[model samples]
Target: MAKADITLRGRNYSIACAPGQESRIVALAGQLDARLQHIASAVGDIGEDRLLLISALALLDELDAARRTARPSPEMERKMAEALGAASDRIEALAARIESGG
Candidate 1:
């Protein structure tokens, strides 16, 4: 096993991973820390727990959107087009708000 030390929101965490995966773990933590920082800047550090929840939801939303568009069958694609559009719009609006520091 290998351990990676990462800092997020000014706190440090040591995470264990496969021997060769230490760098990947560190990179993932970096990405997560970046997301947390962006959210904190936008919302003014509501709380670590809340910020984590919001960040998780945002990531899940992106994953869901990606899954929905990932080469679905023609019928499925047609059925999902409207819903995907709505989701994309909502995601975009949320991103805009965050970017604008709201």
Candidate 2:
């Protein structure tokens, strides 16, 4: 496992992930924090736990919408499959690099 040190909302956390995934994990945390900040701005000073809960719900809502709208034509499906495969290859390569300590 690799450890990533990241700061969100002025707080620091050490997160562990599969080696090369540290940057991606940090990026995800940043996205979550941005959502939390937006919620805070709109609603004023909610407690930390409530802010986090609301932020999660907001993101989940987005995911649900995306899932619902993702019915694609055959050609578009093929293209999306290709893109996903390429992304998978890149992730595998990054994992290999981390495993080799490169």
Alpha-carbon shift of residue 54 in model 1 (angstroms): 0.4
Extract clashing residue pairs from model 1: none
Displacement of the residue 3 alpha carbon in candidate 2, Å: 1.3
Residue 47, model 1, lDDT: 88
Q: Where does candidate 1 stray beyond 4 Å?
A: 75-102
- Tens-digit per-residue lDDT, 1-102, candidate 2: 799888878899999889999989999888878877888999999899889888888888998999988879899999999999999999999999999999
lDDT of each: 0.92, 0.89
Instruction: Assess candidate 2 and give its lDDT.
Output: 0.89
How many steric overlaps are in each model, in order?
0, 0
lDDT of 1 at 35: 95
Backbone clash total, candidate 2: 0
Scored against the true structure, residue 99 in model 1 reaches a CA lDDT of 100
> TM-score of each candidate?
0.68, 0.67
Clash count for candidate 1 is: 0
